[model samples]
Target: MMESMISSRIDIIKPSGIRKFFDIVTQMEDVISLGVGEPDFATPWHVREEAIYALEKGRTNYTSNSGLLELRQEISRYLATSYQINYKPETEVLVTVGASEAIDLAMRALINPGDEVLIPEPSYVSYSPCVILAGGVPVAVPTTEKTDFRLTSADLASCITDKTKILILPYPNNPTGAIMDRENLIDIAQVLRQHNILIISDEIYSELTYDGEHVSIAAIEGMYDRTLVINGFSKSFAMTGWRLGYAAGPEVLIAAMTKIHQYAIMCCPTISQYAAVEALRNGMDSVKRMQEEYDRRRKLLVHGFNEIGLECFEPKGAFYVFPCIRSLNMTSEEFCDQLLKTERVAVVPGNAFGDSGEGYIRCSYAYSLANLQTALERIGRFVARVKQA
Candidate 1:
C-alpha cells in the first residue's frame, strides 16, 4: 500500500549503480576503491580556512535566493577569465547547492511534459532520471570509443525530433573522462545552429582538462545564448563537500531557475558560499597543482590497464579511465564483482553509466599512487585468472 503511494517516477528509476558497488565495498575489508569520482584530495587549505573564518564571524545567515553577490561576482570573473564567456552576476547567474542542483533546476525549469531531452550515453547516471522527474522524456544518443566518446555532429543531428528540447553536454565526462575539444564543439555547434534546442553544458570537470585549455560551448559564436553553463568548485578546488556550484545563462532562464531554487532550496549553505568566493579568487594555483598530480596518475593507470590487456583509452580530462573489458568474455558487472571479491579492488562497471558502457569499466585515478599501483596489480591477477578460466 505504501509503495503504491510513492510517485511513479521515483519507482521507475533504479538506485545508482555506482552506489551499489560502493555499499558492498563498505562492508568488506581491504578494498581499494577506484569506484567513486570524488577528489581524493581535501578541500584546499585556503578555501577551508575561509569557511572556518566565516563560521567564526557568525556569517551563517541565509544568503539571497540567488546567492551571495560576492560569490556570484567571483564566479562571473572566473568564467570570463577561464572560458571567455561572460555572465552578469546580478541577473544571469544562479548559485546552486552543487552542479547537481543546477542540473535539476535546468531540467525542471525548461522541460514541459512530454518534451524530450537528449542525453549522450554512457553518461553520469543523473541526467536521465532528472529528466524523468521533471516530466521530460530522455532520449539516449549513444556515443562510441570510435569518437573518443564525444557527441558528434552526425549523432546530434540524427537524434533530434520536433519534441526534443534540451541537450545535456557532459564533457570531461564522469565514468569515461572524455573531453570535447574546441574543434569538436565547433562541429557540434554547426548542427545545433539549425535547431532551436537549449544546451545544459555540465562542465563540472572543466578545470581538470589535461590536453590544451578547456573550451566552453557557450563561448562559441551563436551558442552562448542557448547554453546553460554548469560548473562548481568540487573537482578543481577539491571542494566537493562544500556543495557550491553555479549556473550561468540567459537572464530569463536564470530567473526561472532561481524562482524554483528559492522555493525548493532557499539558498546554498552560507559558509560554503563564502568559502567558494575565496576558492574562485585564490584557488587556481591549487587547482593547477592537483591537475598535475591527476595527470601523473592518469598516465599510470592507462599504461597499467593496457599492460594488463584491458584495452584502455587515454583520457585527456578528469581522473577516470574507461578500459574495455570485452576481451575477458564477461560482462562489466561480472568483471567488477569478481574483481572486488577476489582482488578486493572496487571499480564501477561501465554499464552503470548507461547501456552503451556495458563492455567497459571505469577506474578512477583520484586514488593515491600507492593504492592505485596495488589495485592495478590485483586487477592484473584477476584478469589472468579470468582468462585462464
Candidate 2:
C-alpha cells in the first residue's frame, strides 16, 4: 500500500477553504468574488517601473541570503517611523518570499517536537498548519464577537501550559478584521514576559488599520527581545504578486531563518526588492488612497449585510467582515455553497478559519464597489427566497 511509503503527516492537512473557493470561482463566469485576500489595486506605477528598470539593467541574479541592503534598510526605516519599532537592518532582518514564507520560516526555526503554539482562533489559515509541519502542536484559543474578536491577555494566560513554546499574534486580523490597541498589547506583553514565551507578531496588514494607527508589540519595553515581527508589501503596497516580505527579530533567530532561506528560496526576487524600496519610500500616498477605498467598501458591505439581516462585526482593520448567519439555520459551508451555485457570489465559509468561525461567513471588501453592490442585491434575493421556503 502507498500508505507505507507516503508520509503520514501529509495526510493530516488537506486543501484549504481559501483554495477551494478560488478553484470554483475561476471556472465560474460573472462571479462576484469577495473571498480574495489580496488588494484589488495594481502596484503603483513608480514601483512597477523600478522593477522594469532593474530588469533592463541586467540585475537579475540573487542579491544575498538575506536581501539587498538598501531594501532591508528601507524596511527598517519604514517600521521605525511608522510603528516605532527599532530594528537594525543588517543584523535583525531577513527578507523572505513573502509573509507566508516568513511565517513558515519562523515556525521552523523556533518550534520543536511536542512543543505547543498558542494561537487565537478565527485567524489566517496558515498558522496552525505551519506549526504542525514544524512538529509543534497548535493550541487555538477562541475569540468572540462579544469581545470585538480581540484576544485578551487573560485569554493568552488561560491557554498557557508548560509545553507552550510560542504564541502567534495576528492582529489587525484576518477573517474577523479585529485589531488590538496599545493597552491590550501591553497587558499581553506582561503575560508573555511572565511566562517567558516568544511571540510571532504578524503585522502584514499594519498599514491598513482604519480606526487608528497600527501598533507593534516590539515597540513595548521588554518586548523587542522576544518578538518576531513579520511584514511585507503585499497588503500595504498592492504588491501581492511581488512576493517579497521580511522578518525582524534578534540576530540569533534571524540567522537561523536566513540559513533556511538560503537553502529553500536562495533569494527573494531582485526586481521586487527594487520595487519595494520605491513602495516604502513613496508608497504611503498609494496606501492612503487604497485605505480610503477599502473603508468605503467596508461600510457598504457591513451596512448591506445588516440590511439583509446578517448580524456581523464591523472590522477595525484589514478588509474583511465576519458575519453571523445562524439565523438562516444553515451551516457556513452549506450557505456559502448554495450562495455560490445560485447567485455566483463567492464568499468563504467561516469554519475555514477555525472552530470559532462556525455559523458565520467571511467576505473580503477588496473587490470593486460595483461588485459589492451587485453581490448585495443577489444575496438579498437569495436570503428572501430561502427564508420564504
lDDT of 2 by residue, 269-324 (tens): 99999889888999899999999999999999999999999997889899999989
Candidate 2 lDDT score at position 380: 91
- lDDT for model 2 comes to 0.91
The runs of at least 3 residues in candidate 1 whose Cα sits more than 4 Å from the true structure, single-residue gaps closed, are 15-22
Residue clash pairs of candidate 2? none
Q: For residues 1-389, could you state the per-residue lDDT of candidate 1 as single tens digits? A: 99889988897677876676667878998788898789999998898999999999999899999999999999999999999999999999999998999999999999999999999999998899899999999999999999999989999999999999999999989878899999999999999999999999999999999968999999999999999999998888988888889999999999999999999999999999999989888888999999999999999999999999999988889889999999999999889989999888888899988999999999998889998999999999999999998
- What TM-score does each of the candidates earn? 0.98, 0.96
What's the CA error at residue 35 for candidate 1, in Å?
Answer: 0.8
- Model 1: what TM-score? 0.98
